[model samples]
Target: MPRVQDVPSIPPAGRADDGGALPPVLDVQDLKTFFPTDAGTVRAVNGVSFAVREGETLAIVGESGSGKSVTGLTIMRLLGRAGAQIAGGEIWLTRGDGNRVDLARLADADMERLRGSEIAMIFQDPMSSLNPVFPVGEQIAEPLRLHKGLSRRAARAAAVELLALVGLSDPARQVDAFPHQLSGGMRQRIMIAIALACEPRLLIADEPTTALDVTVQAQIIALLRALQARRRMAMIFVTHDLHLVGDVADRVAVMYASQVVEEGPVADVLATPAHPYTRALLACVPRQQRGEKRRRMTPIPGTMPSALAVPSGCRFHPRCAHAAARCIEAVPALEAIAPDRRARCVRWREIGP
Candidate 1:
């Protein structure tokens, strides 16, 4: 069996981007994650690839179970060893120096050492993510002590600082309070503080505002955007709503049936979606345009395909409105339909610009 001690550590830190106007901080290529289920193999993430550049926010937009969440976990190497594993491809992450390391190939120990210091993740549910027993301040300080090599006292002080940074009230006293003592919004703020504690280059926010009220949701999104700008960190914002994407994302990747059906600039792609799935999702978003009081939101016709028994040709063919005979006969690879834009459907052009 492969072991942590046997896996080699990546080279010394180098420049985050090799050298370009906006070089990639994370460059994923042909990533495939599979689970060995009793019923059948579950291809949770199949042949997925995307690059997040320095200081850019790339939103992975999709409905539940489209593998958007799994993709983030895979990048962080958070999947447990027993059930699922990365079957193929590379996850190239640029070091502080100009060089890059393939995270997929890194040893478990190497990944652990890098996870908090270079990459951080904020899960969907803060209440569940935080420990009821431990104080939230201690939770935030744990990573600082572990990865940043700070003393317990120093880490605690830093935790208080982080709390203030995230805009928590009375952070000095709040630092000593338990998770159960905090409100839902405050707990989410704690999660953000913990995620940003290490000042990581990449922040993977997995539906951070899903549990908040509509008003609170907007507040959290604005807070995150401000933090991202102040920190100048590259972010992978995972969510199901295009509405949320519009607020924080510079680019967007629409995932369906465990694959990215379309990708491009946020404004461009939303304005003129290339894939049927993208258009369907956009149609579902509540919009107010022109003199119309409100546009009718149309839900996508069918549910996402089962990963265990994905459709043979296009995984989305059964649910795709514009699926042609060719779409059902051959699995279309994600290819560029236009400069800086890509879609998986072979007949994406026919669907419209």
Candidate 2:
């Protein structure tokens, strides 16, 4: 495997280099998103921070309820309907024109204008995200019409081209088809087409491969890589599967109980995880060596703690095998464990390789 380049601690605002030395397209600092429920305030995402440079893919992976999805939604400003609020933090996005703006502080009108033009998101379920009443072509053309001010006829023509761009066959005919008329993979392709219509600088793909079979999932992954490379766009790939992260992401951030426990290059983190939660996650992935007996996968011992009442000290202490007494006394800061790696565990040096 090739050595992964180190991501700068503070990314500058500009274009990317072929050697992965460019500044971050999106830099999230101490993001805290909360939802006030009837029972209590749900801290869906707490003090989560990461960055993705132009043409780079950052995968946020964890079990369900770990706040990976919420973090992505928060970045897209799509959690307003869910009654979620940004209690604190900054979401800095560098525009295509090299202007940096704090998305958290951007006005609603400004954010709305930036959504499809500067940043786009591909949701998990196409059926729910796509309008059944409208043709797929019109759905793809909506962003072009609204953001690019394209005429109806030209937008429709571009939609067909987008469908074809995403590997859909006979896009001219399929463009007129309703959401229900297509297969799951095809619908997903249509969603990708709509997202890429405006050629946004950044894309937030929230579990875009859900409900997809292995074959179709591979195809979608390849298509996304091709498109991202061609457009030189940054992407946040959110998923629960760590196995998928190795295939797609340049860097991986492991989240647990609304916080990031570990983050580093995909190769280094997977080979030598610096956090207990990250180790437990890798253990759960089933793997077998050639000419050897298959080992039984060891499931992570406990469920993730409730966000409303997260455990003190180390949030992952309850499920960590090597947890110690000090883990319950006070919370551990996400500190540097290696040259380019960070882990939220006080005993990382004692416990890690």
Candidate 3:
């Protein structure tokens, strides 16, 4: 296990196209996470790879059970308690000091030390993530106390500031309020405050606005954008909504049955998808054109395949409308479809726009 300090820095060769000369803050390469169930080993995240540069947001979009959240949790190393394991691949994380470390190989102790200060995660459910009995301020302050070694009083004061930063009204009074006292949106804001308290270099927000109303959801999205802009931190936003992707994410990776079927700039992918799964997902989102009535969403024909028994060849072939005999013969590699885009469909040239 390499110590955080001893990890060597990554060479500044592959700079991001949009983020100037900065290297990716988090580069996940071929990550595979598995869970051993009573029936079989569930490959929750299989061969997933993507990168997020500082101040950039990468959205993992897919339907329920498509491994979007699993990939995020895998990156955060939060699946151990649930009997999941990193089966293979590298999770190269660039640290604040310019050193890069493969988090997959890091010792649990070293990883723990890096969790709050270098990387943080906001779970889907704030109510379940927060300690019910503890005051929201204390919960936010806990990371500051542990990571920064701040005095208790100072940590509390900083927590109040974070609440305000996240746009929570009456931060001073809200700090003393318990989780149960807050509304769903407020609790989500508290969760965001806690995640951002340590000023982590990379933040993984897993469906941050899932439970909020439309207005509050919009508010949360705006708040996240503002916070990320101010802090210049890399973020991975996991969600099933393509609508939210356009607003929050710079790049989008579409996952299906534990694999990334398509990946590219959010605008490019949304406008003209390259993979069948990506197109299917877009079709499910209701849309309206100029001088035209709103089009009804066309639901995908089949459900996501079970991770424990994923289909051979293309995992998405079962649900893909463009799947041909060749698609079922062998698994297609994630081939580059364009300069900055990739798709895992063999017939992408023939079927893609």
Candidate 4:
């Protein structure tokens, strides 16, 4: 194994040797991931496209079963080789050599080589992701040892340092404790340590802060943002917390019915949403406001349609408040509503902020 610094130098996303902006770190195009069941194929991800610039955070936000997590898993190829697989599109990642490789087409063995060294994922539910019997330190060290070729003793030492970096108390003692022995926050920090062990160029965080309390979620988000800046890494943050994306993500990709419905800067999308689904989601979050009576939460009128039987034309048409006759007959492409902003609604112009 070689030091991370020994890798070939790649230009940042927004700079070039020729005085122009460089390519994005990760470019996903028309991605589709499906899982075949006895009943039907589950279109977990459908025609999703987005990009992550170096040192930028792109949040994929949606309701449960809307396929935010599946998109992340598809990028990492974590769904494995057997039943579930990518049915279409390219996941183009910029190599350290300044060249691009399509992860979607890489061989399994070759993809495994990139898993920890070039790309890492911080999974949700540390208790389920981490080994129950093994000490958390050992679990964290496995990636370091396997990817970095560190000796057991050296890996253990590095594990303690990583724990401390993530703000775990008594790193030495914590390293030796099992996953069940730690608090939810502590376990999450351990998961972060493991994901950061190799200093991956692209980090995929799949709802890592979901289970933690408000305080802990804030801490983890802050830590992740700090780490991204310190390491200058590109990140894809998948979560259902539309409220949290503004704090950590540079951009937002709103998913619905397994497809990207909107994409734009965090402030623009959250403050003045263009899509009906995005607008409805914002209305649903619990926020603090001084009022005579608490404001009512306006949940989206209908539940998301099942992936096995997505609605015709626009996937959100059945639930859209402004659904026109054409909406149910013609699928709308994600079109530019502003500079660097896009929405999948045909009536995006008429949709108020």
Q: Count the backbone clashes (under 3 Å) in each candidate.
A: 6, 0, 0, 0
Evaluate all candidate structures by whole-model CA lDDT and list the values in order: 0.86, 0.89, 0.89, 0.88
List CA RMSD, all candidates. Answer: 3.7, 5.8, 2.5, 3.8
- What would you estimate as the lDDT of candidate 4? 0.88
**Tens-digit per-residue lDDT, 147-190, candidate 1:** 87899999999999999999998999999999989888889999
Higher-ranked by TM-score: 1 or 2: 2
lDDT of 4 by residue, 162-187 (tens): 99999988999889999888999889
- For model 4, the superposed segments whose C-alpha errors exceed 4 Å read 1-19, 286-293
User: How accurate locally is residue 95 in candidate 3, as Cα lDDT from 0 to 100?
Assistant: 87
After TM-score superposition, what is the CA distance of residue 21 in candidate 1 from its true location, in Å?
A: 3.8
Write model 2 residue lDDT over 201-293, tens digit each, in one string: 899999999789999999999999999999999999999989899999999999999999999999999888889888888888666669878
Clashing pairs in 2: none
| Clash pairs detected, candidate 4 | none
Model 4 residue 93 CA deviation (Å) reads 1.2
**Model 1 TM-score on a 0 to 1 scale:** 0.92
